[model samples]
Every structure is written in C-alpha cells, then in structure tokens.
Target: MSAPTSNIADFLRWLETERGLSFAGYPELWRWSTEDLPGFWSAVWGYYGLHHVSDHDEVLADATMPGATWFTGARLNFARQCLAHTTDARPALIAVSETGDPVETSWDRLNEEVAGVAASLREMGVGPGDCVAGYLPNIPQAVVALLATAAVGATWTVCSPDFGTPSVLARLRQARPTVLVAADGYRYAGKEHDRRPHIAEIMDGLPTVRHLVSVDRLYASGAAPDQLPRPDVTRHDWTELADRRARPVFADVPFDHPLWILWSSGTTGVPKGIVHGHGGIVVELLKALGLGVDLRADDRYFFHTSTSWMVWNLMVAGLLHGSTLVLYDGSPTHPDVNGVWRIAERTGATTVGVGAAYLMAAEKDGATPAAERDLTAVRSILQTGSAMPDSTWDWARDRLGPDARLQSICGGTDICSVLAGGSPLLPVRTGRLSGPALGVALASWDAEGRPCVGEQGELVVTAPLPSMPLYFVDDPGRERYTRSYFDVYPGVWRHGDWVTVDADLSVAVAGRSDSTLNRMGVRMGSADLYAVVEGLPRIADSLVIGAELPDGRYYMPLFVVPEEGEPFDDALREEIVGAIRQSLSPRHVPDAVVPVEAVPRTLTGKKLEVPVKRILQGARVSDVSAEGAVTHPDMLAWFARFAARLGSGRS
Candidate 1:
C-alpha cells in the first residue's frame, strides 16, 4: 500500500526540507515533542494558525502535577480561533436531533449566533472566570451557547437534559454559574420528554443562576416550562436574548484561564468538576484532530455523543482545525442499531464515531449498514467509551466497508481528548489502539512500578501534557485531584486502566485495573467476562464483581439482566457457562450466576462495576453513591440487600 498522506506527514516533510529539522519516524518526533516541549508546542501554535491576542514567551513554565502551566505570557480567546475558520469556505456544522430535522448552520450564521449570545451574556455581567452552565441536548443552540461563553472568557459546563435534577445539580451547583441555558424538553425513542418540571427543580436548587435561558424546542409540542418566578433572572424566549445582540465582544485572557468544567462519573460520593484551560485545549485539540485523527480542513466529522460527554467538546473543537462538524442529538439506537449509520449517510460524513456499546448492540440487532446503506463518503470509523473486543473488530469491518479504517480511540472526560489512539503513521491492528497519543509520555507500569511491555499493568503518563485538568473545582489544595491520579503512583499520573503495551508498541486496554478480576493467579478484566456473556442472545446485559470473602475465598457473582420475557432456566445457564469456558479459561467461569431485573449504569452509559463491587463486598450503599446521581438508584437496592443476605449467611 502507498504511504499514508496526512497533515502530520506533510508537516513533518515541511520541517525536514524547509525548516531543516528532520525526523526519521514518529517515535523521533514523539521524543522531540516530550523532551523539548517548548519547541513542539510553539510549532503547533504556528502550524495550526491559531489566533492569539498576545505572543507567548514560555511554552511551559511549571511541570509539577496540578501545578503545570503552559503558554506563559499568552492571551487568547478560544472562541475566536473556533470561529476564525469559515462558515462559507467550509460548512461549519450540520445538526440533527430527535426533536427536529437536520439543520445546517453556516459559519457566518454560527458566528452571528455566538456573537449574539456573547453580547447578551456580557451585558448580563458574565466575564472572565464566570461560569455558564447548560442543561441541553446535542443541538445547535448548545454549540452556540458554548462558543458564546468561551468567546467572552467565561467558563462553560454542561449536563444532558436527560439527566435527573440531582445529577445536574451535583456539578452545576459547584460551578455556581451565572447563567443556566436549558431546554423545555427533548425527544427520544419516538417520544417527547418534558423537562420543565426538572428545570424548575434545577433552577430552584441552584441559587447562583442569575439568568435562566430556555430553548423552546417543544414549540410544535406546545409544552413549555411554567412561568418564571423572576422575569429579571429568567427568560423562556431564547431567541429574544440571542437577537438582542448580534455582535460579540471577544475577551482575551491568560493562557491558563479556565475555559470549561467537566464532571466525573459521580458513581462514588459527589462528582468532581474538572477544570481545563483554553490554550492547553486549543493546542491539544489542534494536534489531536489534525494528526491523531487525520482530520483535513474540509472533513466532516460526526461523533454520536451527548452534550454531557467530553466527545461533545471534541465535536466543537473540530472547528478549530477547520473540520466540518455534524452534531447529532438523539438515541443512536432509537429507530434501530443502524440509526447512527443513517446519520453518516445523510451528512456525507468523512468520519463516523460511536461507542463500543453501540457497536455491540448493532451486532446483536444484526445490523448491516454496508449492505443496507450507502456510506461511501466515510473514511474512518472511530470507537471508544469502552474497550473494543477483538471479536467485535470483525463486526466493525463487515459493516463499515473494507476501505474505511476502524480506529479504537481511547481518552477520558478528564482530558477531553485522546491520550492514545489511531495515528496516520502507525499500522492499523485489529483490537488494539494504534499507540500513545503524540506528546503524551505514556507507559505501562506493573504493581512494583516497573515498566512492562507486552503485559498488562497500570496505565500512567510519566510526563505532563497540556490538556490534563488544571485542577478540580472546589478541591482545595488539590486534595481530591491529587488523590484521584497522583496518589497511586506519586509523581506519575495513574490513569486507572489495566493497559497492555504489546510487543508491536500498540496498546490494549483491559478495563479499569481497580476492578481487575484475578482467579487462581490469572488476572482478567471484567470487560473480558461481559464480552462473552453479552454476546449470548439470551443475555441483554451483565455485570460481574469478584467479591472477597472473610475466609479468603474470592466469590465471583455474575449478575445478568435477562432478555425481555425470557425465563432464566437451566438450559440458559448451561449455555452461558459453556460459552465462558470455551471463550476463556475454565477458572473464568462465575461462581454464581444470578439474574437481576436491571444493570446499573451511569448517565453516560458506563457499567457501574466498581460501585457495585463495593456494595456486593459488604460496603454501605450510601458510601458507594448518592441516590440522585445514579441512573437507576432503585436497582442498586437489590444488590445491597443481596449483599446483606449473603453476609448474614441467610442466602
């Protein structure tokens, strides 16, 4: 095959011939980037044509964890760079939602909308360091609101409208936003959900919101939130304020100024609000989109994600490098497992992104997008959210076409961008992420802290990157932030994943290491177990936890949600056990196979394994999570009560 031609390759070629800087391969380029961080970053700023209000004198001043600072003496507005690209030259965005049809927003109009909102927000006394929270869907208005907040140097945070009141309040209350931009309701699965009552609860719970701007999405449905208590503090007509000012006044702030606040899963205790800066994110996304994903100036990118997910932020960041964004809102599997592929076909997207769970469901649904749909425009298929099973790679290949690449990208909400994933320079391998993301000093360290290659160990970043959270909101002295990552490995950032760096230098993630399953001296991930179990047609979903008994025997309980109306009979149990033994080792079989009504998941769709493990291991339910933050709070009661019965020796 011909050598891959990408923006990074071209940039590298340019450096060799024009700038007299030569590198033989990506490893050398990576080394130079991590070693001389200043040179690497300055080159990124120049290469991407980022707009800066003032020049940066120092690329990185401090390198300490939770203390690192980048782009010293620089001033810029992230919104300016995001808007600088063009609505006319390249299509800015095409938005499709369950509530409405596809709506295309040109760069010029998008700029106008952002400017309009920014002007109103500034007039409302929002400025640098202020917070603007949104309870919104993945719609155009959410994008506009976010850019407007960034344009005026205000910190932006968001929660999906689908989240319960307590979940939204857990993070937004800590942000203490001056404005809360929300929706009256949203549609999903061919049904409209009215959120006006939830909006009232959120507004009442948060005393800091000075303005309530509600997007009238249910106009045709004719369902609106109740009248505002204080007209001065709230407004239902979103257009009135957006039209009030069509010219945005941009604000230039320090490089380290907070740009957005993202929340943790909140499965344990209160959620943590992670703060990330403008310059760091700008540089990081520019490289990530341009090099890691090979997004060209005109490539149309579509990632199936909610506004609440960090991938939503990446959808907006595509604008930074002049990539067209197709923002999608609604259930990916609403109409069926093929719904997301239909979106790619309709938008003529060059890249299609979805979580591994979506792919698994599509497999179960027997979806065949390649045969049923025309996706000739798609060039890359991106998968994340969970580890992509080796078997699932075949499923991806059969549906996405042979020409298109299927990349299992890995990143987290904490960074808001990929730390390891596909690269144009690397060879694509089935079931393995290509390698460490450029500029990230990643290594797999064993329990004794020795670097391990071709073996599973803790994932760690030995050096600091710009996109790591600046700090956690409300975390004084960085106490929570410190314990979250650094406490495990001292100076190194422990990413909490069981990762194996293979001999080929490719990376394979084996789920979270803290919840790693060990039996008879062999260690396996819970994801490994679920992969086999969920593949069975009888199993809709499953959760596995290795509970340690006082007598030192490890009790492995497999909780499964049976398929609708399907009886949990002896025949089904035998099949499950046979599959596990055939696919995995004999010891991989569960000690107890229990059927449950539902499996607890986060609002973002992650299985609640760690929290469930603690509950099953005799920890108090209250210690695991607060009721409101959990997606299925009542479902946890079954696990807790079961644990009690088991502990009392009455089961």
Candidate 2:
C-alpha cells in the first residue's frame, strides 16, 4: 500500500525538500505555521494538491478576524476534491445499523449516485446560493445528498431524525431551503420510529421548501409511513435520484463560496447558522484529519455520531483521504456496552472517535472491550465533547493496549474542525490534550487579556484560521458573528472554554466558560430550554445547567419556580421531562428537576446559569459571582449547600 499523503512526518519531510524548511519538533513547526501564516497556508494548498481548476494570486488577502480572506482568485468544489481520492480497491462508505444488514457502497457507485442527485437538483432550479436541507439519519443516503448539494454549488444543512419538529424547524426556518431530503423513518435501539408526521409538520413550517426527496428506509421492514400529508410540494423517491443515469459534473465556484451551514446557539434563544466555504474546508480537513489524526488511505475511520453534530461532517471528510467510512445509525449502547467496540472490530476500523462520556460509561458498566472484542485494528482513539478524568484514561489505555494512541480533543461546531487536538509528534497525557493544532494560534488568556500558563484561563486564538465561518446566515453587517466571538476579546476568537496551557505545550480544557449546556457531546443553548419550560403556564421561571464533574460524570439539573397557587410535584416533573424530550430532544432532558423558591438572576434580568454551574462543580460562591451583581444573592449559598449534599461523587 502507498504511504499517507499528509501525515505530520510526511509533511515535515516534504517541507524540507520543497521549501527548505526544517524544524526540531511539533512546537517549532506549530510556531512557524502561525507566525508565517501566508507561507504555511500556501504550502498546505500545494502539498494537498487543492488547486483544482484555477490558481490563487494571494494566500491571505486579509488577516482580520471574522473576515479573513484566503486563497483569492481560486476556484474549486469540495465534492470534487472528495471524489478525486476514489479508488476501486476499497468501498467508500460502509453503513451499519443495529438490526439491519451492513451495506457497502463502492466509489464508482457513490460517484454515480451523487451525480444523479446533482442532475436532479439542477433540474429543480437549485444552483449557487440555494440551500438544500436534510431531515435524515446517519445513513449513506444522507452522505450522497450532501455531496450532491456541494456538486451543484448549493449550501447544505441537516438535522437528525431524532430531533423534534420544533427543534428541526428552529434551524431549517433560518436557512429557508428550497429542497429537503428526508427519511420516512429510522431505527434506533432495536426499535423503529416513524417520522413522517414530524416531517410533515416541519414541511408545513418551512414554506420555502418546494421539493421533498424521500428516502424510505423503513420500507424493507414493512414499517414505512403510508403517505405524507403534504400534497402541495413536489415529491421524488430516493431511488429516482440515485438511479438516474448521469455523469459527474462539478461547479467551479469561488474559494469563499458558502458550502454548508452548521448551527451553534449562544445565550440568545436563536440558533446561529454558521456558513463555511469550499476552499477553507478542503484545505482545513486535509490538515486536521491527515496531520492531527494521522489518517491514512488504507485505514477505516469510524465516529459514532448523529447527523446534527459537527463530528458527522468531519467523519464525511475522511473520504478525502480515500479512507473507508464506517457509519452506525443507532444508539451506542443498544444491545450491550460493547456495541461500539464490536462495530469497530467488525469493520476493521483503524481510527475510532467517540465522546468521552461513552468510554466512561463503558468502564463503569464493567465492560472489557479489548479482552472480549478484537480491536487490534484500532490504531488511535479520538475523544471530545468533555474532559476525561485521569482514572478513565488509565483504564482505557490499559485495556486497549499501550500501542493505541488516546487523544482528547477540544474544538466546536463554529469551525467544524479541531483547534487544540492530537499531533503525531506529541505524547499522550492523562486528563489533557496533546497540544494546539498546527496553523491555530491557541493560548490561555487571563481576565486582562494577557497570556498565561500553568493556570486555567479563557481559551483564545490570536490568529485567523482557514476554516472559520465565511458568515452567519441572516447576520447583516456581520453583527451577530462579530458579537459572538469578537465582543469578548476584540479581534481574537474567544472559544468560551476555560483551559490551561502547561510549559510543555500540553493543554487541558476544563469546560465551557459560557452558559451553553453540552450533554453527551450534543450542545444546546440554555435559551432552548427556557423556550420550552417557561412557556408552561404552571412554571413561573426556570434555570437549567449542565455541569461536568471531576469524576468524568455529567450532572444536568433543572430548577424551577412554580407559579402562584401551583406546587411542584411528581406530575410537574414528568411534565417538564416530557416537554423537553418531545420538543428539544431526548438528549437534553435534565437528569434531575428540583423545586426552588426562586431562580437566581443577574441585575440585568439574565439567568445566572454559568455561576450556578460553577457552584455545582465545587467552586466557592465568592469565586463564582459577586453578591452585588445578583438579584438573589442568598441563592448562591443554597446552590453551595446543594453541592455539598451531592459531594464529590455528584450522586
């Protein structure tokens, strides 16, 4: 087999031969990449052979934050780059489900299906600047639809079938897609869920959608929905688009043209639609997946994720390396704790990525994956979404063998790539990430915006990156985009995570500095909870928080103040959980609900979510907030006492 094209060692050697550049180690190389931004990015483009149809006159046209211009005068398409690595030796996509037979799609067949869908989309008047939405699961059809949308120079966005109608509409309404690709139903945890009613409601809400392409996944099992309730919209079957005879054609769009949209909500209730460009993603993925994770052409990569999470998008990028993608569309712990391990072993996955919580849960469940399952093909394990304890890492390393490289990464949906993550040259450390990613000027800053080391501080990036958002949809004058990252540090990207950078360059992420609730790798805004809970007539107000404990466990609790003449009881708790599960998602349902005399709030009437979360995580009241700044100052003591009762175990 041929060697990988973009690993760290290969890049270093190629740098020496092509540019006469030499560095001692990862740190020196990272410094050069950040300091000489233009030279480094230009080298990446050339090293990856990303110049598809045209050449760029300049690498970095502008270096400003929230408006960085890269690779001007270049023309390329992300789908074209992905298709360039196709080979006849291996399958391009391997789809596995809990109760269904595994299906494999070859490179040639994948190309044909993508071309057919692209042709159909063009015939529907979909072109550049148009949006195509997907309401599907993590299946091969979803992958083909996204690639086809890119092939036609259209922006793609998707939400998993598990999401409720309200949550799905909250995002799709903003994009205003002209075409929607949906699945009639999906199977999860050995059960079939018919989503036709939900899709019909979503379609009713999205008036801009003129076309609906349905993938009948449940038809084989005789559980498909009989008919969709919508008759005004044009309908097409999945087979029609996939079987149409057509040749592959790619649009030569500009470098910064919008490729896809990913949603990341903040303190505000609305979800922000972050748009990434074609050129930025092509180069960034090659660096992040190839160098950071050390992915090779012959390797099989598997990451268990829903279509809603950004990791699903990253997993799709594995095709750029000609690597086989192993996709699972079901619950991770359906039959047993060893489900993920069994899939990895069966698929011969070289790189396995999952949230840290899943491994911790497996360990707690007394699962011996390495002894029971043949995971010898797994060369690396990538973890993200939360901090992993030292004991969890020790347990995983011992069970998986010393040869396995365990990496705890820290990045977000905003960029759809790694900021501080794995490197081939760095050593694995317990409770810490390997280091900052190359081309990312990452640092920990104190309250005064000064760089700090050996102590926890705000995570900030001092330089611009290629994969940053091109713009947020509907964000006129870049107002929302600027206010999201630049308002905190002015010209620097504040990632909202508290981190520590040791002298050796290894980094540790504590948790989110802001009020976002991240439960099992799925991040939801606190405002999303408020929108559901506060709407109830029996609830006067509510505050919800997701806290990561030191023992690798997450505790999410909802505190509510009952309305006048209303009492909080078992019935109310059930109501709250049902509302959250049915409206937002089953993932965001709080672990516990408690009745409170009053909800804590700041003087500005904003809910004190971050302070309450910090208190629950064992911080002092004074350390978290000032008494003068809060409406109910004594509520801090109440939360502190509550933390004391739970103790370190967070029971």
Candidate 3:
C-alpha cells in the first residue's frame, strides 16, 4: 500500500550487474520517465539503438486528449529494428511443435526469403500503404511475410488459422488486403484438416486480392488450380518464391507512421482495426521488456499464443533485448497433457507465459508436472488473458516450485502493453498483480469519479503513456478512439477493467467493466465470484451471472464445469455456497449450481460470461454475432434446459 519506488533505478542496477547492458545518460533517463515522460520516451528511441532516417527538435509539444504526439519530426523504419541482427550465423527463429519436431531459420536466411517475397510483391504492383493480410498460423513463414510487408511500408494484418471462412472474409473485406498468404492445411491434435477449401472461399469474398500464396504444410506433390475457389487468382509456391529473390530494403517514414493493423475481438460487433506506430511500439515494448518483466539477454521466453493475440506482438520485443524466443504452434496438450511442460524443460525457458484458463485446466486434470519435469530454470511465470484465481496461485507454489515467482499480469489489446503488472522488486501477493507499472499513474475510481482505496471501481490512467494506439482504421479523424477510452474521463484514459487497489497499492483485477453485471442495485464483477468458486476442490471452472426472475427480482446463477469425475451434487453446492458467503457477503451466493461439460471461451482463452447470461434469460443466442463466441454452441442449449428445470423448482 506504499507509493511505488523508482523503477529506473532498479533497472539501471540490474542492467549493469546482471544483464551487462550499458547506455549513456543513466541518471537523465531516470528523471525523464518520472518528471518528463515525453523526454523519457524520446530517449528510449535513441537508447534502444533504433534506426531512424530523420530527427526532430521537439520531443512532445502537446498533452491534450486524443491529440498527443511524440517525436513530432522524426522518421524511422519498424522492420529495420526487427531485422537488426540479420546474419547467416545467428538463429532468427526456432519453431517447434508438440510432437518434438523442430524447425530453425537463421537471420540471413529469413532476410533473403523476405527479400524474395518483397520483390514478388513489387512485380504484382503491391506498393506502400497497401494492405497485406495473413490467414495463417504461428509459423516462421508468417513472420517472414509480415516483415516483408512492413519492409515495403505496406500494412500487415493477420488472423489465426482457426477462424472460419465467413469470419475471415468479414475482417479481410473491411481491410481489403491486396495479397493474401495461407496454407493448404494445418495439423492439430494429430489431424490434418484441409484449409484449401476455406482459403478458396475467402478469396472469393475478397475481390481486391491479386495474389494468393499457399505454404505446403501438408507437403503435397503439386498445386491444383481447380481446388482454388477463384480460378483467376494467381498461385505461388513458398519455396519457389524464395528461390527467385532480391535483397530487401527498409522504407523510412515518420515516427508516428502506421506499422500494422490489429483487430479487436468482435464479441459485441464487427472487430475494429487498431493501428500502431513504429517508434512508439518499439520504445514502449523495450521499456516493458527491460523494466516491466526485467527480461535478460540470455533468457529464453515462451508464451502459448497464436498470431491473433497481442502477446505475439509483445513477445517479439524479446528480440530487442537479445533473447531466444521459443514458438509453439500446436495444442498445448497434443498427444498428452504434459506437452507444454516437456517443451519448457527441454528449452530451459527462463520465463513462461500461459493463459490463466489453461493453468486451471491443468489443475482440473490433476496434472502435476513437478515429478515429471525439472522447472528449476524458470524465474518468473506470467499469467494473463483473465484474472488468476487464488487456487491457481496455490497450485503454482505447491506444484511448480516453492521458489518460483507467480506474476499475474493484466493489460489489453487497446494499448498492446500493461498498465499495471509484476515487478521483481515487489512481493508476490496471493492472487494480485504485484504493483503499478513505472510511469503509469493507474488508479481505481468509483462510479462517481472519486478515487478511493480498499474499494472496487473502474480502472483509469491519469496521464498519457507510450504505446497508445495511433488511430482506428475505420474511424475518420480518431472519433472512435476518443469515444472508447477518453470519453469517460475527458483527458484521462479509462481502461475497461474493473479492479480494486488495496490501501497497500497491491492490485486485484475483477473483470471487464463492460461485462460487469448489476443485480438489482449492486454491481458485481464476474471475476469476483470466479475467484471464490475456483477455490473449491470440486469445481474446475465456474461462470457466475445475474438472471432476472418473472417477479422482477434478480438472483445469481452459477454454471460449473466440474473436475473429471466430480458431480454437482447437493453437498458440493452447499460447500460452494458456504465458501462464497464466508469470503464475500451472503448476496454473492448462487441461487443454483448447474453442472456443465465445458465453459465457453474466446480464441484467446477468456471466458464468455455475458453471452452465457443471455442464454439463461430465454433469449436466442444464435442471433448474437460476436467474434469468437462460444467454441461449442451446443453447451448453451444444455444450460437453457437446466435453467428451465431450476425455474420449475424441480430440484
């Protein structure tokens, strides 16, 4: 609950003693972050060894809402910083699957491939400011295409391979990319599903696409033109394109220039395109790597994620610090449930990142990796995508190792960086993010816009920080960006997270403010109940929502997915009620405990509590058009029947 100390001081000492990193103006760097944030960010651009073609005299001249600018007259290349270490001897990428097969690509080889693709793009008349989209998985080739697009100043957009053809078309149609990269098929859970048909359907929807390049993931003999949905769409092989190549050149642009376009999970509506700049992203991520997680040069970083998640973009910052990144493409549990742990052990990963839901799933399966693997090399374990339950923290301490640090981090795609997270200097509390990030003036304000301690409220930032999205692609003059985060507080940024900061300054994330339920008059976050219910041994995961009765009264309805063989009997329900009543108030207790086979989640592994609540109200869920809505839609029908039985008082 004390004020945060200077993180720059700690970063400097760690850099000198532990990381062996040297830089000029160490003291000035500390002052700029705290006193002059604009100067601090400007210094980061130079300190991190970024490539810039132009320089500016003014670091920052405005601090207004939705109009702030950094390094006003500077120009830089995003792809150059990413490919700074390009060489024949250094390994640029190391991709491995759950089956223990490894694929390696050197920096020089990757650069050569990128050059070939860039030359081909020029031949097809794809120039700067054009959009190039990728409907692919997390592979080396995807990274190559992205870099190639950025090298030529073309915007890069991507979606995971799991998305259906309609969903892919909906996004691509909005962005209208000229070139599309896809695969014939991908392997998952030991099955090869053909994506050629899906790709063909996508190309049919995108009439602007001039070229469709397919990677032979299945290793087939020849390309079939009849298999493609659009016969007019020209096809190119991945290897053949690499064979005819040229040297890639970096394009320089303004510091605030657009680099890439990322889409928000269209859970509520059509996904919005978020555009970020090169200088801001590079500097902000470098600060996050050095001061946020305290990443070291020799460290090996691994996160279980797809190309769709922002974590993939965040993890690329590790390369700036000279760390080896371990990429995993297949399911975390392929042939067996222990696949991720096995990879961690073999790779000697120092930092391991996993979604909170995955950790709970492992606990549900009674998975204990302590006896099966050696996790001594792991220094910190990062958990995000949702709030970390208290039971998961206990499992990490007891099962993973006693000495390991469990850091529960919280941030969203809007900023592409964390507003508050774990710090090495801070103590790891039971189920709380360690503390506020350096230079991030984060606070918890109530509905009345009053800052209060020991009270749950909306999380907001008092000042502008680096890495704020430059613009929304569809919005003209930045109207949507202003309405999304800045409209709530005028000048301050209101992050859509419901959280509580204790008197001690320790942070606890409740849930998304947009998803918080109001029962009668009291506001309750979904995470408030999830933390309490997940603490029980009988429950693997639980979703809590407020359901309206015919009499105009609202009651909390709980749906639980029990561990392997556990049932939702009367005794187990009583135990769950007792725990909630003891930890929170009596109002937190659920009116019913309905057992389910699986809880619904988005592609990023976040729970869909609001959509589930709608189903219980006798509302039609099929009318809903949210991106990544319930992976299994049938589960909602089961919940509806259970709700009907509960309403009849038949239990």
- The numbered model that scores best in TM-score is 1
* Rank list by lDDT: 2, 1, 3
Between candidates 1 and 3, the TM-score winner: 1
Residue pairs with backbone overlap in model 3: 1-504, 1-505, 266-627
lDDT of 1 at 343: 86
- Model 3, 551-594: lDDT tens per residue? 46676778888878987788988988899889988877777777
User: Deviation in angstroms for 211 in model 3?
Assistant: 0.8
Q: How many residue-pair clashes does candidate 3 contain? A: 3
lDDT of candidate 1 over 322-408, digit per residue (tens): 778998878897687788988888889998889898898888778898898898888998999887667688988987798898888
TM-score of each: 0.95, 0.81, 0.89
Give the runs in model 1 whose Cα sits over 4 Å from its true position.
1-4, 51-53, 220-227, 230-232, 549-553
Error at 105, model 3, angstroms: 1.8
lDDT of each: 0.84, 0.84, 0.75
| lDDT (C-alpha) at residue 116 in model 2 | 100
Prediction RMSDs, each to the true structure? 2.2, 11.0, 4.7
